[model samples]
Target: MAGNHQQLLQLTYIRFVILFCQCCAVAFALLYLRVDLNPWATGLALLLLGLLNLITYARLHSSWPVTQPEFFTQLLADAIIYGFILYQSGGGTNPFIFMLLIPLIITVMTLNNRYIWMMAITVTAIYGSLLVYYVPVVTALSEHQHSLTSLFNFHMLGMWLNFILTVIVITYFIVRINRALQRQQQSLIEEREAKVHHQQVLALGTMAAGTAHELGTPLSTMSVILHEMRTDSTLSDEHREDIDTLQQQVQTCADKLQHMARSVAEEKDSEKTSLATELLDEIIEQWNITRPDVTYSVSIQEDLPPDLRNTTALRQAILNLLNNAADACPKNIEISLRWEPTAIWLTIRDYGAGLSVEQTNTLGQPFISTKGKGLGIGLFLTSTTLAHYDGDVKLYAAQGKGTITEVRLSRRSVHG
Candidate 1:
C-alpha cells in the first residue's frame, strides 16, 4: 500500500516537470520564434493541468490512499491533456509533440502490465490521430525560404531533440524506480526468513517442554536407588565415592529441569528486571557453576546504566554463547562489557582453534556446529531468542587464534 502511494507521489512530480517544460516551450515558440499558434486552446489546457496537479498534490496528504486504478486514470488524463496540447500546437509537426511519450515511458516503468498496455494504446492513438488531423504550423519565414527542403531540415532537427529528451526521461526515472523495487524485494525476503525462524523456535520450545516432563520420572527413580545404595554398609569405600558423584550428577539434572519449568512460567507471565551490571555478573556466575573447568576474565565499564529487563531467555542466550566459547577452549576465555547511550556491547573471546570459513558462514544455522558432538541448536536458539530482546550476535576471528563473539543489546529493549 505504501509502495503504491509512493509511486503516485512520483507520478505527480513527473507531471509537474512535464507541465513546466511544456509551458516554457509554448511561450518560447510564440514570443521569440514568432510561431503562429492558437494560445487560447493550449493556455486553457495548461491552466487546467496546473490546477489539477495542485489538487492532486493536496489529495496525497489526506487519509485516503491512491489505488492502482486511480493511478492509471491519472496517467490516462495526462495522455489526453497532452493530446489537446499537441492538437493546438501543430500536432505531429510540433517539435514538442514527442512530450506525449513521457507519460507512456513513466507508465511502462512504474505501473503493471495491464496499465502499460493501456498507456501504450492511448499514446499511440493520440499520435496517429495527430498525424492525420492537426493544425498546420505557420511561421514568419513561411512566405520566404519555407520550401520542402527547409521544412525537411527543420523536422530532422526536431527528431534529434526528441531522441535526446527520450533518453533523458528513461535514464532518470526508470533507473531510480528499478533500484527502489530491488530494495523492497530484499526487505520482503528478510521478513519471510524471520517469520520462518520464529516458527522453528516455537516448535523447539514445545518439544523441549515435553522432553523435560518425560525425563522427570526416570530421574526420580534414579535418585531413590542412589539413596538406597549410599546406606549400604557392604559397599567398598571407593565404590561409595563413585556413587556419591553419580548421585550429584543426577541431582544437578533434576535441579536444571525444575529451573527450566520455573523459567518457562515466568517468561509467560512477565520477564523480571534487574540492574545491567548485576545481570551480567549473575549470568557469568551461573555459567561458571556449570562449566567449572573453564577459566574466564571479565571487564565491565563503570559507566553502565542501572535498570535492565533480563529475561530467562536472554540469560540463556548469553550462557549458550559462553558455553560455545568454553567448548572451543575451556582453559582460557576473555569477557568484557561496554555501553553507549543507546546500546550495550558484550564481547567474549576464547583462545581455541579458530573457525573455518565454512563454519563461520553457517554458524548460527540449525544443525551447524563447531564442536564434534554439538547438537547445533544452541547457537540457533540463542540467536532467535536474542532477536526478541532487540539484540543480535556477531562472531569474528580473534587476533591470533579463536573466535570473538560480540553480543549487542538495544538500550530501549534492556531498559523497558
Candidate 2:
C-alpha cells in the first residue's frame, strides 16, 4: 500500500510539472501576441507563481507526509495566485479567466465532501468579487473601448458558462473515480478477511479433531474399568456407585468432545447462523462460565430494527468486543447497546489498565497484541467484520478511567 501511494504521488507530481510548464508557455505567448501590458510585472508574477509551484511540489515529494489539510492549502494557494494573474492581465476580458476552474476541478478530484464545498465557496467569492470590481477597468483600457464593451460582456458570459460546464464535468468524473476506488478497496479488504477467517477455521478444526483423537484412549480405559467393577460380585454397593459416577463423568466428557467436533466441522462450511438475541444470550452465558471472576452487565435496546437483528457478522463482532472487554476488566465490565435511526451503537467499557498511544495505534492490526499468547486475530476479525457493514470501531481511554471500545454500525434503514 505504501509503495502504491508513493507511485501515485510521483505520477501526480509529474502531471503537475507538465501542467505548470504548459500554463507558463501559454501565458507568455498571450503576452507576446496580443496584450503588451507591463512585461516586467507579468514576468515577475509568472516567475513567483512558478517558484511557488516548484516549492509546493518539492514539499509534497519530500519526507514529510502530505495530509488532506496540506493538500487543500496548496490547492488554495495555486488558485489564488492564478486568479490574481488573470485579474491583473485583463480580469473579465482575459480568456484565461476560466483557469480558475482548474483548482476547483482538482479540489473535487482530490478532496472529501467538506473540502470540496470550501473550495467551491472560495472560488465563487474570488471570481464574483473580481468580476464586480475589474470589469469597468478592463473595458476602459482596451484600444476599442466601445467595441470592447460588447466583447467584454461576451467574454465574461462565455467564461462563466465554461466554468459551470467544466465544474459539472469534473464533479461527475471525480465522483465516479472515488466510487471506483472505494469499491476496489472494499473488495481487497473482504478478500483478505476471507483468507484469514478460512485459516482460522481450519486451524481450529484441526485442533478439535486432534483433541478428540487423543481422548479416545482415556475414554476406553475408563469404560473398561467401570465395566470390570460392575461385573465383580465382591464389590461393595458404595464402590459400584462410585464407579457409576466416574463412568457418567467420562460419558459427559465424551459428549462434550463430540459436540466440539461437530462445531468444528460446521465451521468448515460457509453457512452462518442469523444474529438472533439468543446468540447474544449464549455468548454471555459462555463468558460467565469461563470467566467467573469478571462481572458483566449487558443491555440491548429494544428499538433495534428487524433487519439488524439477523446480521450475523454484526453479532459476531459484538461478541468479540465483549470478549475484549472481559479481558480488559477481569473485575468489572459494562456493555450497552443502543439503536438509533441512523446507527446501532455498542459500547464496551472496562476498568483495567488502559492502552497506551502506541498500543492504540496498533489496535485491530494483525499480530499486534499485549498478551503473551495472543495472536491478535480477535480484534482484527472484529474490525474487518464491522467495516463490511459500513461500521466503525473506536477505542479510547477515558480520562482518569479505563478503556472504552465503541462499535457503531450504520442503520440499514439509513444506509441502504
Candidate 3:
C-alpha cells in the first residue's frame, strides 16, 4: 500500500515537471519564435494538465492510498494532453511527440505487466493517429517566413532538448528503482540468515535434550555402583578417594541435568529480577564450584541498577563465557559488572594469549572455537540465548594480553 502511494506521488511530481516544461515551450514558441499555432487549444491543454496535476498532488495527501488503476488513469490523461499539443503543433514531426514515451516508461517500471502493455498500446495508438490526423506545420512555418535552414535548426534544437530530458528522467527514476531493489534484497538476505540461525539453535536444543534424557539412566547406574563400591572395607584409601571423586562428578552431572530441565520448564515464567551485583555474585559462586582452580576477580559498580534480570538463560550464557575464559587461561581472570538506566553491562577479561584475527572472526559461529578441545557451540549458544533478552555479546582481543568478552542486556528483559 505504501509503495503504491509512493509511486503515485513520484508520478505526480514528474507530471508537474512535464507540465511546467510544456507551458514554457508553448510560451517560448508563441512569444519569442513567433510560431503560428492555436493559442487557445494549447493553453487549454496545459491548463487541463495543470489541474490534473493539482488534483493528483491533493489526492496523494489523502487517507486513501493511490490504486494502480488511478495511477494508470493519470498517465492516460497525461498522454491525451500531450497528444492534443502534438496534433496542434506538427503531429509526428514535433520533436516533443516522443515525450509520450516518458509516461510509458514510468508505467512499465512502477506498474505490473498488464498496465505496462496498456500504456504501451495507448502511446503507440496515439503516435499512429498523430501521423495521419495532426495539423501540418507547413502553413504555420510559411506564414512566419521561416527559411528551410532555420526550420531544420529549430528541429535539431527541439530534438536536443528532448534527448536531454529523456536522459535525466531515465537516469533519475531508474537509479532510484535500482537502489530500492538493492535495499530489499539486503533485507531479505538478513531475514533468511536469521531464520537459519534460529533453526540451528532449535536443532541444538533438541539434540541436547535428547542427550540428557539418554544419559540419565547411565548416570544413575554409575551413582549406585560407586556408592556400593565405596562401602567395601577391602578398598585402599587412595581407591576410596578416587571413587568418592567420581561419585561427586556423577552427582554434579545429575544436578546439571535437573537444572536444565527446570530452566526449560520455567523459561516462560522467568520474570524474576535481581540487583546487578547480586546476580553477578550468584553466577560467580555457581561457576566456582565447577572450576575451583581457576582464579578470577570481580569489580562491580555501586550505582548499578537493582532491577537487572536474573534468568537461568542469562546465567548460563555468562557461565559459558567464564568457562571459555577459564579454558583459555586458568589464572588471573577479571570480571566487571556495571549498569545504566536502560541496560546492564558485564565485561570478562581473561589474561591469556590474545585471540588471533582468524579465531575472532568466527567466534560466535557454531562449531568454531578458540580452544583446541572445545565443542565450539558454547559461544554460539551464549549468543543465541542472550539474543532472547535483547542482549548482545562481543569478544575483543586485549592488545595481545588476553581476550575480553563484553555482554550487554536491555533492562526491559527484567521489567517484564
Against the true structure, what is each candidate's TM-score? Answer: 0.89, 0.43, 0.77
Clashes of each: 0, 0, 0
lDDT, candidate 2, 1-416, per-residue tens = 33223323443453355355435544643443334455455556667766776676566556666567766777687677766666666665565566677667776766689989999998888788677665222333354334656666666665675566556545554655566568767888988977876676567547657878999889989888888878999999999898899989899888888865665466436244434345567667766775678877777777533335334455557767777777776666877777666777778888878889998888987667856678776787687777767888999986777899998877663323
The TM-score obtained by model 3 is: 0.77
Which regions of candidate 2 fall more than 4 Å away from where they truly are? 1-282, 299-307, 311-314, 413-416
Q: Taking the tens digit of each residue's C-alpha lDDT, what string does model 3 give over 1-416? A: 55567666776767777778788888878876777778898889888988888888888889997688888888898888999989988899888887899889888877899999999999999999999998766535544677788889988999889888878876777677666656766878988988999999999989999999999999999999999999999999999999999999999999989988998899769747788787888889999998999998888886635677677888889999999899889899999988887888899999888888899899889988777788889999999988888899999999769999999988887765
Residue 292, candidate 1: Cα error in Å is 2.5
**Best candidate per TM-score, number?**
1
lDDT of 1 at 66: 72
Candidate 1: what lDDT? 0.84
- Residue 416 shift from truth in candidate 3, angstroms: 6.1
Report every candidate's CA lDDT: 0.84, 0.67, 0.85
TM-score between candidate 2 and the true structure: 0.43
| CA shift of 14, model 2, Å | 23
Q: What is the C-alpha RMSD of each candidate to the true structure, in Å?
A: 2.8, 14.3, 4.4
Off by over 4 Å in 3: 1-9, 27-89, 101-129, 133-154, 273-282, 296-309, 334-346, 408-416
